[model samples]
Target chain A: DQQVKQNSPSLSVQEGRISILNCDYTNSMFDYFLWYKKYPAEGPTFLISISSIKDKNEDGRFTVFLNKSAKHLSLHIVPSQPGDSAVYFCAARRTSGSRLTFGEGTQLTVNP
Target chain B: DTAVSQTPKYLVTQMGNDKSIKCEQNLGHDTMYWYKQDSKKFLKIMFSYNNKELIINETVPNRFSPKSPDKAHLNLHINSLELGDSAVYFCASSQVRDITDTQYFGPGTRLTVL
Candidate 1:
């Protein structure tokens, strides 16, 4: 069963525009949500994360918003740059677990 | 210096063969993990080790085993590999054995079984 889902397989946006990526999860036991960026032939790197206690978290040009009621979360990058283009994976960790369950990644392409 | 490194970036082997992938981290992290990225592009945790002790095994097949000789190294050995076992394996490490900590990952080892 896929506890986490990224409905959009790929998203394209022009440079300097705002890019939004969405993720949904069915597991309410998750204590935190995380986003990772991965390039071709490279391992994924941590981008940002939001705790279940908080509704939003921001770092630099990236912001993550979580809606507990909707069981959904989103990552927004303002003034998107080509360098920010990569496959984004949304992951969740249960309150009592140390492993991360990941969703099928979404490929975000920022066209220059 | 590489925070986490995996050897044999790409491996091609026949079914029934056995192979091993070595991973080492220089970040001084106490927790280490192995993740497999399948064809569907979902990263799944295979095993987790902390302080040279096996902490978590995600019901991976018995054919796949993880060995941590020391705090900074974790190796995965697969016996009688099957075609379905082909996937990209990634090694990661964190300061503490918690999901809240940031995990640094290696480039990954792409294994292909025929």
Candidate 2:
């Protein structure tokens, strides 16, 4: 069973525009959510995260918003740059455990 | 300095062969984990070790095993590898924390079994 799902396999946007990526999860037990950016032949790096207690978390140009009722979360990047072109994976951790469950990942392409 | 490193980035072997992948982290984290990414690009946790002790073992087959001699080192061994075992394995580590969950991952080891 896929607890976490990224419905969009790929998304394209123009540079300097706002890019939004969405993720959904069925496990309401998850209290911690994270986003990771990965490049080809490289490991995924932590981008940002939000807790169940908070609805939103922002870091630099990236912001993550969580809706507990909808069991959905989104990542928004302002003024998207070509450097932001990479696969984004949404991950979640249950309240009682630290083990993370990840989504299939969404490939973002920022065209210059 | 690489925070998490996995050796033999690329490996190709026969179905009945045995192989081992070594992993090391220099971040001084006490928790380490192994993740497997299949052809469909689904990342699944295989095992987790904290302070050199096995903490989490998923529903993986007995042919796969994880050895952690120290907090900073974790290795995965496969015996009589099967074709379905071919996938990219990632090693990761994180500091001991109950609230803040942050993990660093290695480049990953791509294994192909014929």
Candidate 3:
């Protein structure tokens, strides 16, 4: 069973626009959520993350918001750039677990 | 310097063959993990080793075995490979002080089985 799910398979947006990607999870025990961006033939790079204690976390142009009651999270990139084009994977870790469960990635294309 | 590196970036082999993929990390992290991405692009954790000790083993088949001789190296060996074994494997490392530690991943190794 997939605990994390990224419903959108692909997304397209114009440069300098805000890009929003959504993710949902079925397991409420997950306490930490992270987003990773991956390019073709390359491994995923850490982007942003949010702890269950907080509702939002921001790193520069990237922001992650978590809603515990809804069992959902989202990543938002403001003023998106072409370099932001990549597949984004949402991952979650249960409390006291060392392994991460990843969702089916969402391919984001930022058009210049 | 590469933080994490994997050898044989692409491998094509016939069914029933045995192959090994080596992974080494220079980040000095104590935890290493193996993840597989299938054709549908679903990434799943197979195994995790911390300080050369087996920590987490998922529901992966017995044909796949993971060995960590040291804290910085983890290798995956597959015996009697099947067609379903074809996928991209990624090696990652992290410092396990807490659950918030970020993991660094290596360039994935793509394996194709005929």
Best by DockQ: 3
Can you tell me the CAPRI class of model 1?
medium
lDDT of 2 by residue, A1-112 (tens): 9999999999999999999999999999999999999999999999999999999999999999999999999999998999999999999998433678999999999999
The residue ranges of model 3 lying beyond 4 angstroms of the native Cα positions read: none
Write candidate 1's Cα lDDT for B1-114 as tens digits.
888999999999999999999999999998899999999898999999989999889988999999999999999999999999999999998887454777789999999999
Stretches of model 2 off by over 4 angstroms after superposition: A95-97
Top-down lDDT ranking: 3, 2, 1
Error of 1 at B39 (Å): 0.8
Q: For candidate 3, give the lDDT.
A: 0.95
Clashing pairs in 1: none
DockQ of each: 0.60, 0.64, 0.73
The candidate 2 chain B region of ten consecutive residues with least summed lDDT is B95-104
Clash count of each predicted structure: 0, 0, 0
Give per-residue CA lDDT, model 2, range B49-113, as digits (tens): 98999989999999999999999999999999999999999999998677675889999999999
Model 3 residue B105 CA deviation in Å = 0.7
DockQ of candidate 3 relative to the true structure: 0.73
Worst 10 residues of 1 chain B by lDDT: B95-104
Candidate 3, residue B52: lDDT: 92
Give DockQ: model 1: 0.60
